[model samples]
Target: MEWDWNFVRQIMPALVEGVKITILASVLGSILAAIVGLAIALARRSPHRLVSRSVGWFAEFIRGTPLLVQLYFIFYVLPDIGILLPPLVAGVIGLGLHYGTYTAEVYRAGIDNVPRGQWEAAKACNLSARQTWTHVIIPQAIPPMIPALANYFISMFKETPLLSAITVLELMNQAKIVANTYYRYLEPITLVGAFFLAISLIAVVLLRWLEQRYGRMEP
Candidate 1:
């Protein structure tokens, strides 16, 4: 079929709306992932063996499963257990939890990269464990981790399309709706790809800026 300019114009509004939802979901989900992942990372590094092992197993479990399966379990299986969430909530939870596992690894890497001497110095100063973490280790570790955390935000942005499977009506879902209704997949799908590419490109530039800004602070 020939390129359809009229169809593109007609669907532009819906696509724009869908893009907004996609952006919101990605942003909120990333926030959740960052917080949850940090907690998991700290748990994994705890002196207590049980806390560390439990967190390690949970992270491994999440990483091993397909995101689609996790989405299904959250959206479908939960209702059977008397817990029902809206599609949008389920989508956010699924995306955030899945990416949290990935970010935990990133956080662990950053925390590990903090030199042993720093930890020793904190001890030598007679700092409490919490004081050591807050003042010395985290201040050093978190700067390097910013780039990785920002990268996860971009990754989650692309993965928002998976929300369509659970009917979240995000960008890809909107595109698919337009294609189904109008019987023109090329324009809508092409627009979807272009939209995602544009957003991802912008995210990459922002992440690089963050990396450079933070990288300067490290000794």
Candidate 2:
């Protein structure tokens, strides 16, 4: 089909809403992933063998499974057990949980890279465990993790379309709706690609800025 500027214009409004929801999902999901990942990383480092092994296995389980399957399980299966969530909430949780496993590795690696002396120093200083982590370890570990975590953020943003499976009106879903409804795939599909490309470029710029800003270890 020939490109239809008018049809593009008509769909712009819907696409705008899609962009908003997509951004919202990405932001919320990234925040949750960061928090969950840290928790998993720390738990997997517990002194108790049972706790550490169980948490490690759980993280591996999540990391090994496909994200789509997890999303389906959360959105569709959970409701069968008296747990119901809004589609956006379900999608955010799925994205966060699925990606959190991967981020957990980043967290673990970052923490490990902190020199053993740092931990020894914290102990020598009589710093509480929480204070050591909060005041010393995490601050230092996080700088190097920025690039990896930002990469995951972009990946999660790209996968926002998967949210459509649970009825999220993200950009791709909106595009699909427009295409299916009007029987014109060219304009809407192309628009979707263009929109994604634009956002991705912007995200790249932001990632670079973050890298420059926080991707360094202080002397």
Which candidate should be chosen as best, given TM-score against the real structure?
A: 2
lDDT tens digits, residue span 52-127, model 2: 9998899889888888888999999999999999999999999999888889999999999999999999999999
- Residue 132, model 2: lDDT of 98
Tens digits of lDDT, candidate 1, 1-219: 888898899999999999999999998899999988989999987889998998899989999999999999999999999999999999999999999999988888888988899999999999999999899988888887888789988989999999999999999999999999988899999999999999999999999899898856653
Query: What's each prediction's clash count?
Result: 0, 0
lDDT of 1 at 4: 86
TM values, all candidates = 0.94, 0.96
**CA lDDT scores, all candidates in order:** 0.92, 0.92
Stretches off by above 4 angstroms in model 2 are none
lDDT of 1: 0.92
